[model samples]
Target: MRVFVLDAKKRSLDPCHPARARQLLKSGRAVTYRYYPFTIILKDRLVENSVTHPHRVKIDPGAKVTGLALVRDDISKVVWAAELEHRGEIIHQRMLERASLRRSRRSRKTRYRKPRFDNRRKPEGWLPPSLESRVANIITWVKRLVRWCPVSAISLELVKFDTQKLQNPEISGVEYQQGTLFGYEIREYLLKKWSRRCAYCGREDVPLEVEHIIPKSRGGTDRVSNLTLACHECNQRKGNMTAAEFGYPHIQAQAEQPLKDAAAVNSTRWAIFEQLKRFNLPVEVGTGGITKYNRVRLGLPKTHWIDAACVGESTPKELFVKCSSVLVIKATGHGRRQRCRTDRYGFPAAHAPRRKKYMGFQTGDLVRAVVPKGKCVGVHVGRIAIRCRPSFKLNGFDVHPKYLKILQRSDGYEYEIHSVSSPGLKAGAPDAI
Candidate 1:
């Protein structure tokens, strides 16, 4: 519904309606800038003041993927939507691979000192590589979104499940419950006691619902320790049957404690909130239930981008979505910090790229390329690999330099691509996987 505008020198001024952009283009007062989130640069100065509006960025963060949406307050239409795929698992695997390779080197005749891990200590705000990447990815985009558009405020979904309620949904000890946790209704005691898993199914981090270990239909009382968290499917399947009757007798022998994932999320959530607060913007946090409610109520599929649009306090009643397009981004951190590339046999083959930028563009820069009529026709938008001569790689496809146009530059992280469901807007498409 709205298009972003830049001054003659490409400095962000304010956003205007599509009609104004059209008029400016027709009168030769402006030229098109970016197409994904359409923006234009003015060639003429305007006597009228900048028409600025409060824009909001919402986030729905997950372990694997994160959803983001930018909406103009006046129109409530989505200016941009993205599904950011993370490389946390890849990073973890790479770390493990390095450790294994180092062990093999130690076994061979490679000269080395004793393991020096004892001398190294974790820095402050240290998180496991994967979780740390997740937090940093969210923070990175929060800043990027601000660069392209004037984001007045940010909203995020903080926690998936209330720990206290997960343990004891209804406790009569109001005084005791209200003492610690600063009035947080989540009773993490039960979650911690159960090792954060389903007593019956032993699964975790799947939007767990509170389940009674004993069937209430069979005279079971509402005891805090008797409750457990289970996935929706398991909860419904158990269907009021006691754990014993539900064929989970082995649960008694299994260890009871919060699952690793549950503990990580519980431990890192407040830290993420605190980091966002340092951005100096009015950041709003919401619960997972609130995001789900808004998505279901809006009759939208449960995609990450949709969940992001439904993030916090000022949930839009309607979306001004002109196109159902997604800007899929993958975090490809600032190249690699390592110096050399090695083979699986532990022999050094070559060194990594010494510089981030080549030619005029960086590896993660977004570009549009038009090939000749022989093989690939029409313009294709994707991340580019700046290479030699007239040829370059556009998202793994070979292309020439003359046909490429730079859309956005890499900011030391992430690569963006454009994907659409159908021609002129696809209907009845599946939710983003």
Candidate 2:
């Protein structure tokens, strides 16, 4: 990915090539500013004298992971891309654990407290903590990118699948109910529901055909619940027999179940869309249909960032991907607020340090330590966990704070650059930098 650049006055400028940034640093023209999204500050340049093009920040929001892309629309080029992994599941689990602990403590106490469940009223637009975190994560990154780059517009994939329409097609009115694109929506929903594999044979990497669980001749309608994907062999072998008669009763049951991930995206998509409007930029919204169509039309592989780049109708016919790497950011929130740590049985295991920082070093701060002579005898660079003593944990090695130099403060998120030849091409093959 290209390196973000800022003028001497701390104003955002156009990001420069990695090689150009290197030359600027080596020649004493620019100095390092931030480490995570690797930015630099020029010593001689000013934003007024430099020309910067308008960039669009596109988002492909998901339940667990969201894709972000910084696109130079004027040139139809993608300059930077990132995949943000959310902690909704983690947050949910933590909330459950906290509730369990509270209940246990209350039951063990002598003084009884009355339940006040009905006393609290949720305000309008209220979302569960887990769902709210996803929206916050996307908005945080959008704000960060806007500050780092010249972002003028935003594009978002507002909805992946219309659950209501999928369940009751007639509610969409006659025109859309019989529209050509209706089948496309159903097929996409099925693909995601069945994990893109044959529902009967579990076969993948082959052409999958939509098959009826209960044959239409056998009193089955075209409802989504009766739909299942099958390979040609399975489809032919099963013939007109229902799924239960074909030996897989579970297929029908699973088909009737709603996709939890899809529901999550639907719940928070509008929240993100509305929150983004506060940025005072044109927030373009698109459906999953157009995103997939653009990706297939461009012959690009399926990846979150690529989906983000192909989000809106404004996407160019020809897209130029200018980066060979993508930034993978995972939300690892700051340490918990509880001072006491508990065990699995809700017993106090240990107490946290009263002070978070020691000797000006805190846990999760990126630092570099040079060990003069010891078992860890070389320079170690990584996040550090500080204690009351001078010795601190640096990449699992004990190092004195005197030898440690802070690089970047803790920001509740971990960052890594993954090398990719093309967008979403060989996605599983990521060489970390």
Candidate 3:
């Protein structure tokens, strides 16, 4: 029985109050009929009187007290005792008991209830089962991607407006700071322009927020012309800088796409290659110290590699680096050849086939791992890492490697090969030799 300390006063609990009598009422004590007797504690005194009974005790408002105790299937009998204090000495106390207030719950031998399902309404859609399954899979994939990718990065593409300047700063001297009313105005304008479509992925369902092209603090003006509608994730990834600043290695921006448009633009960059024709590097490559030059010198646009490709949808990794681009086979220091690949948006992609072993999972790769059974159980089950590492590190009870195990192919779907369990490390688990 659950007991509670409701309202406390100077009096000791008494066991003979009407509340105690109510406990007895819950369980049938009278000899005539076996109907369950209802119980009610009319006053605070009755509750205060029943604190010593072995069955239960309580002192509180009637509503809370009522919720605390009830006659149930297994709890057929109840005994209550009251506890109180008075005049420097403990006072009234009472003990109440009741047998079984057996109410007829149900007649087991009765006939079954008639079916009540409606058959008139016909199902609407005509989609095939396989198509529905594919749609579900796509939805799951998109959801996983959203979860895995940083919100800031996604937000940049969705919001396409300047949060720094209200009217043209050159025209109106009003210098609106970042994340201010001007920013909201720019965000609002973009939302109206795009009708809430994701500027990158063309997804219309997800809501978009306003993002700053040039950071507000960096003397960037708050102008609707400069603002864009991007999702929250993309906005965060863009942070407080022009897209031209982030130098990612995996994804590059398209060359034909000019940097003049107000749509959130990310600069694309190609890796420094030994010998290449189609690829363009931002810096001059040589055996001497790496001489980094501005994007203008390399015949490229102003936006950063991160801004042009990583933040926007439909931006392809291959566009950042052409196969014809000279691959810097190796680098001595930051001097001779810094190995560069196309910079990815949120996730780092496998640049070389051989590099896959060194890297773990990416945003979409499905791998079987384990999770702790409960908060403290120490037991675990196989799980999948939906996102990439580095950008997101697995820590504590949720993503710790101590509880992970990758599932292998060919084995039955039910079985999984534990990474730590293996004698030798393979598949990026650990080194076996």
Candidate 4:
């Protein structure tokens, strides 16, 4: 990926190639500004003296993972891309645990208290805490990218799948019955629901056709609940027989199950779309149909970052991916606010430190340590966990604070760059990243 650059006045400049950034640093013309996204500040250049092109940040938001891409519209080149993993499920589980503890404590009857009535009213547009966190994460990154790069526009995949239409297409009349988008929505929903494999044989990476659980000749409807993806061989073998006749009775039951991930994406889609409009950029919204159309037309493989690059009507016909690796960012929130840690029985197991920092070192800060004469004698580099004493934990080893040098402060996110050769890349397509 290219390195983000800023001028001496702290104004956004065009990102430079990694080799150009190296030359700037070697000749004392620039200095490192941030380490996570790898940004630099020039000592002698100003934004007025340098020309910067406008870039658009495209987002493909999912339930558990979101894809982000910074594209130069003039050249149709993708400069930087990242995948952000959400913690909504984790947050929901924690909330449930807290509620259970509160109920248990109330049953003990240690003190007499009046029961409160259900008079609390939620404000308009209020989402649950779990869903709100997903919106906050996307908004936080959009603001950060705007500050670091010259972003003039934003494109977002507003709707992944229409659950209501998929359930009953006749509700919307003729348009829903015979629309190009309805087919795309159903195909995408089925792919996600069946894990993108053949329902009967579990074959992957091959062309999948939508097959009926009960053949139409057997009085089966075309609703989503009756649809299942199958490979050509399995579809042909099934013939006019139902799934049960094909010795896969379980397939029918699984086909009727609704996809939880698709529901989550639908719930938060409009919330994120409304939040992006507050940025005052040219916000462009696209349906899932166009996104898939562009990706297939370009012959790109199926990946979150690649989907982000093909988001809207503004997507170019020829895309030039300029990087070999994509940055994977996971949302690891800041430390908990609770001062007391409790065990399974709801008793206090241990008390947290009153101060989070010790000896100028805090937990979650990336650092490098060179222990001179301890059991851990070699060099170590990772995020540190600070204690009240001088010792700190680095990659599961103890080291003193004197030997540590802070590289980057914690920003509530963990970063990792995965090359195209990594196992996460699907379809075995040639590396365009």
- For residues 176-281, write the lDDT of model 1, one tens digit per residue: 4574344334447557756787666678776677777765554444555456677789889989677777888655223233333455566567767888898789
Residue 216, candidate 3: Cα error in Å is 0.9
List ranges where model 3 is wrong by over 4 Å.
1-188, 245-433
Q: Which lDDT tens digits does candidate 4 get at residues 1-433? A: 7789999988898888888999999999999998878999999999889899999999999989999999988777888889999988778777777776666667876332345788999898788888888999999999999999999999999986766666555567777656534546889988988899999999999999999998765656586788899999999999999999999988876555445568788888999999999999999999888999998988788789889989999998787764578889999888878787878767779999788788887789999888888688988889998889877889998888989999999888998888874323333323432
TM-score per candidate, chains pooled: 0.65, 0.77, 0.16, 0.77
Residue pairs of candidate 4 with colliding backbone atoms: 323-433
Worst 10 residues of 2 by lDDT: 424-433
lDDT of 1: 0.71
lDDT tens per residue, model 2, 12-87: 8987888899999999999999998999999999988999999999999999989999988777778889999999
Those runs of model 4 whose alpha carbons end farther than 4 Å from true positions after fitting are: 110-116, 164-258, 422-433
Native-to-model Cα distance after best TM-score fit, residue 322 in candidate 4, in Å: 3.5
Which residue pairs of candidate 2 clash? none
Against the reference, the lDDT scores of all candidates come to 0.71, 0.85, 0.28, 0.85
TM accuracy, model 3? 0.16
Q: Cα miss at 42, model 1 (Å)?
A: 2.8
Estimate the lDDT of model 3.
Answer: 0.28
Error of 3 at 266 (Å): 33
